[model samples]
Target: MAHLDTLDDEVPDISPYVTPISPTNRFYRIDTALTVPQVDPESWRLRITGLVDNPYELTYQDIRSMRLADYVITLSCVSNQVGGRLVGNAIWTGVPLYELLQRAGVQRGAQQIVGRSVDDFTAGFPTTLAYDGRNAILAIGMNNEPLPTRHGFPARIVVAGLYGYVSAVKWLEEIRLTTWDGFDGYWVPRGWSKQGPMKTQSRIDLPSHGSRVNSGETIPLAGIAWAPTRGIERVEVRIGNEDWTPCRLGQAAGNESWVQWHRDWTPSGGGRQQIQVRATDGSGHTQSGRTVPPRPNGAEGWHTISVDVR
Candidate 1:
């Protein structure tokens, strides 16, 4: 867990929610294996095996030829600290996992759906997640373009609301259906929680940290907030020692996408000022105040930043 926590510093900061349509280059990527797996699409095959009644395989083209669906989903890494940039939103296009599993005829007593990457890194979630109507997919495209090699070239799994460790298996090659007691993926043994549900999170993008600004000038305090499968209902910002003030929200792209938010603030006196932000989900859940490090599960805490005004 200590090593995983340190990896958060390696991720470059990007305003994940500011642009719900995050550009491909700005998307944060964290790979467990030492080297990125090179997968030749033409030779790539997705194997469906294990407890299923019918084991089968599908090529990259075969997946594309199937009925395709596009969705704007936000992915958050469990290793992401409060205000971290390890989250991104993009329109993903792929075949539904439910449809694929149905075709394979998942047998009775099956309890988990495991996805194996070309690098041999594996991640699995409960079988119920595939059919839970949360829009799980075997994504082949991202932001209207083929997935970038570093971000899972051929295909990856995207499940709304879950942390990337549990659902964002990249360079995906195989899905095995098995029992709960069957196996543990890469992160499980590393001390991460099996069910990586994302916690409510928000960030401050503008007034770049440590930037000098004019005192008494009206400045926009803004950023993005997300609650995964549940949309962000509202965002609020607080100036040093002031009450939380509501901020206007931008149109959310989809139920699983992040929403943009901003509030205007005038600095009365300038020295060193701290800005804090928090969010409430559509389900009426507010971000927690107690800070927790990203470890066995996702992190929980309000995102705060400071800047100097001249």
Candidate 2:
């Protein structure tokens, strides 16, 4: 077993799904490294090469010297199952990826942007995401603190809306521009798709499954929903056989971040009640009812939990 599972394997961890920003330590991590790569910030360099007219190397200082912006975005692992915890939101400080690509003078034939980590893990996405209004950055800081080594010490790649497998690469060392057929990421050969867009999803945190609660009192239920670039339009909750009811949403951080939502329900009859939650994305598409695993791309299905009401 991997040493840092905090339970079984480091591949999965409970996410700190708090609002606005989650505490850094509690933020979830998902990566392919068996051993964390230790890097010397002084000697570390980011190479922007391949299909660019101005290929160059950027030192850690050189990367951070650019005007950086703070982006509050949510990142989720491709392996995160429905209602799973391999997701987190944080404020990342970094330079716009397009800024770096602009400096490199992306060649006309470049279609893919491959981010390769020191450990040799690579993820490829469309090069257009950077200059075409998508939220893409080379992050140096997370939640106001220097990027923790556990999360990607000196730098990482972050592109909102896409699953981490396709968009987030930690301990990043190179940004290689290539064509669609130029390369396949590690996961792509493992059967996952080249593109891993996140599915609209929501989960109930309070009144956890199998917990007992007083029947007469109002059941204060709350959780989070995320749709990323499309943004969460709204969240709905269902109790027992009741129709879906709108949940009161907490302040929305941005279209790229998760939103908090809560609902207070008074059960007229007490027993074992089943609760389910779903979300609608800004595109007006509701979460799918079809249950799917996280292997090929991402998970889908309404998050369901059962609680015993006394």
Candidate 3:
């Protein structure tokens, strides 16, 4: 049995960076050690076994037979630094994981369910989370389109309330119930936390850096924030050490995705002004004033950026 206590105790404070306009423009350098396998749905089968009384192997047709539900979700990579672009919002469609697990009848002593992806990457999540009723899906589609090759393709696992490392298992193939003993996922071995629930955080989007804006004119500042499953309760904006003020949050795209916010601000004789954003979740959890790195767990603190008004 592998002890969870052996995991590293290091949690670096979040490093705040000016939120870039083109956060996803940079190439996400892939680690050469991680292997990605090509997927063919015709040859694909999802095997559910180990610690289940009725071991089942499901074909594509079988999965398609299950009822499909749709919802929007925000996925953030643990490697994404504070204000980084490794996050995206998409509408996903698929069968609920708990429904399938109920059909399989989990056996006693199964503490964790190890999900293996076609890419050969693996992550283990606690069984309690896997069976939670809130939007945990064996997703086959995204944004009303087939899952893209780079984004899970044939099938993936989407679990609410956790970081992408464990909740978003791309190119999923097999799920095995385990005892939480001698189990470590791809990122876990690399010093990430086994459990991840996204933190409450917000970003600044309008009046991009290096862009010219009219001085003393009211401009709409916009961005998005999320606290999955638990919706973003409130968003606040601050300009240059000013008091935080509430911003208007648009209709949420979905329960698991980012909520858009907008606030109108007039530049006060500014050469350059720093705008900051923070959010509170439905649980009343507020964004941390203290920053932290995005590792082991999700990133922390508010996102900020500076823009010039000419």
Ten-residue stretch with the least lDDT total in model 1? 1-10
lDDT for model 1, please.
0.84
Better of 1 and 2 by lDDT: 2
| lDDT for residue 181 in candidate 3, whole number 0-100 | 73
State the TM-score for model 1: 0.92
Local distance difference test, each candidate: 0.84, 0.85, 0.72
RMSD of each: 6.4, 6.3, 9.3
Instruction: Name the runs in model 1 displaced over 4 angstroms.
Output: 1-17
Clashing pairs in 3: 2-182, 13-292, 13-293, 14-291, 14-292, 14-293, 193-296
Ranking by TM-score: 2, 1, 3
lDDT of 2 by residue, 190-300 (tens): 899998888888888776789888868876778889998999999999987888999877766788988877777776667888999999999999997799998898899
Report lDDT (Cα) of residue 124, candidate 3. 81
Sorted on lDDT, best first, the list reads 2, 1, 3
Clashes of each: 0, 1, 7
Q: What range of 10 consecutive residues in model 3 has the weakest lDDT sum? A: 1-10
TM-score of each: 0.92, 0.94, 0.86
- Report the C-alpha displacement of residue 93, candidate 2, in angstroms: 0.4
